[model samples]
Target: MRTKLSSTIFLAILACLLWASAFVGIKIGLPYTTPLQFAGIRFFISGLIILPFCSQRRDYFRLILKNWKVVFVITLLQTFVHYSLFYTGISMVPGALGAIVVGSGPVFVAIVAHFSMPDDKMSLKKAGVILLGLTGVVLVSLERGSLSGEGKLILVGIALLILTNINSGFTNIIVAKDKDKVPPLVLSSASMIVGGLMLFLFSIPIEGLHFSAKPFEYYAALAWLSFLSAAAFSIWFTLLKRPGVKVSDLNMWKFIIPVFGAIFAWILLPDEHPDVLSIAGMIITGSSLFLLNYLNRKKIVR
Candidate 1:
């Protein structure tokens, strides 16, 4: 049991790290493409990347057909609605800011899971830990300064990102509840393919067929984004299927995303840099995860 728990934790961290880097990748790629267009292409290719690796390659389409509802709903919410809001939000704000907004997702997931899953109901202790994590995220974001100058654009972005989290909370619940219905890889591949195609097609009419020459850097970012989405989602979906995994608790590990996301943006983006508050926030966030794990081990909280 201990070994299995350790493995789950390790994989959770690995998925979080991969997702963290996506902020940098998205920022890198968005310079050359529309948000929906970039998101669509990235996810479509990510689905293809996962296809060949599925165990029953011959029965892939059959599995998708059998689990059409699960695939369709996940495709609609996770890839399409989630990424559309995500890409649009991130494009409006700085990478670190975007990370901070998205990092608050666990809070939403916790709330959503509490109401949706009897077994995953919230406890005061869990709520406190989540808030602690959010505090750290806020501290990291404080260095970005007031939205007074950035105006309603950043506000709109923040709102959209929050909506994405709410959507994600429900999506995670569906995946967890239906864990036995379909394999994670197959679900992810099918949903991403359909969702990505939807976004790409929709982008044509909305963003207006924008195909132009982009630099090598753009392709590199796009490729890296696709690969990360493939690997991270697969890892995450697999974790969700594991027995004893709580959607809320599992998502607490995601607080690491903003900490690393901010750090990466500081290092990679010429315009972004770490401040004292950001570093302090990272430490607090890491401490929150430690507390969360300790509590879980003690079985003090769900």
Candidate 2:
């Protein structure tokens, strides 16, 4: 049991760290292409990247067909609606604001699961832990400096980001509820392919055919983003399907994203540097995770 618990924690952290790295990659790639088109290509390639591992199962295509309805729903919610709002919102707001909003995702997911899942209902302890994590996120984001921008546009962007969180919560519930019917690889691959294709086609009309000759760094960023997306989503899907895993509890791990995101920014982006607030935020966030695990182990919260 200890071994299994350790493995789950390890995998969850691995997925979150992989996702965090996308912050640097996206920043690098966005200058060369439109947001939707870049995201589309990244996810489309991500689906293809997972294909070989999936091919090991001879009946993979058949499973995807059988689970097409759920796949379609997931594609719409997870990729289409989620990223559409995400990219649009992030573009409108400051990056620090975007990071805080994205970091708050787990809170929304917890609320959604509380109402949707019988066994995953919220508790005082869980709510406290989640808020504590969000506080850490806010501190980390504020380290970048105060927001100085158009108020109305920032509000609108924030609203869109909040909606993305709600959409994500619903998507996660669907995945958890349907975990038994669809294999993780099939669900992830099919949804990413179909949804990514839709985004790419949609972008061509609105964003226009803007992909042009670019430096080696752009391609490198794209390649890294694609690979990380494939691996992270695959790991996440498998973990979500594990027996005894609760949506809210599992999602709390996402609080790690911004912590690692800050670290990655400091390391890779020359403009970024470490500071006291980020370190404090990291400590607070880590404490929340520890509190959550302690509560779970003590059966202090359900």
Task: Flag regions of model 1 displaced more than 4 Å.
Answer: 91-98, 149-156, 300-302
Q: Give all TM-scores, in the order shown.
A: 0.94, 0.96
Clashes by residue pair, model 2: none
Task: Using TM-score, give the best candidate's number.
Answer: 2
Clashing pairs in 1: none
Please give the RMSD of candidate 2 to the true structure: 1.7
TM match of model 1 to true structure = 0.94
How many collisions per candidate?
0, 0
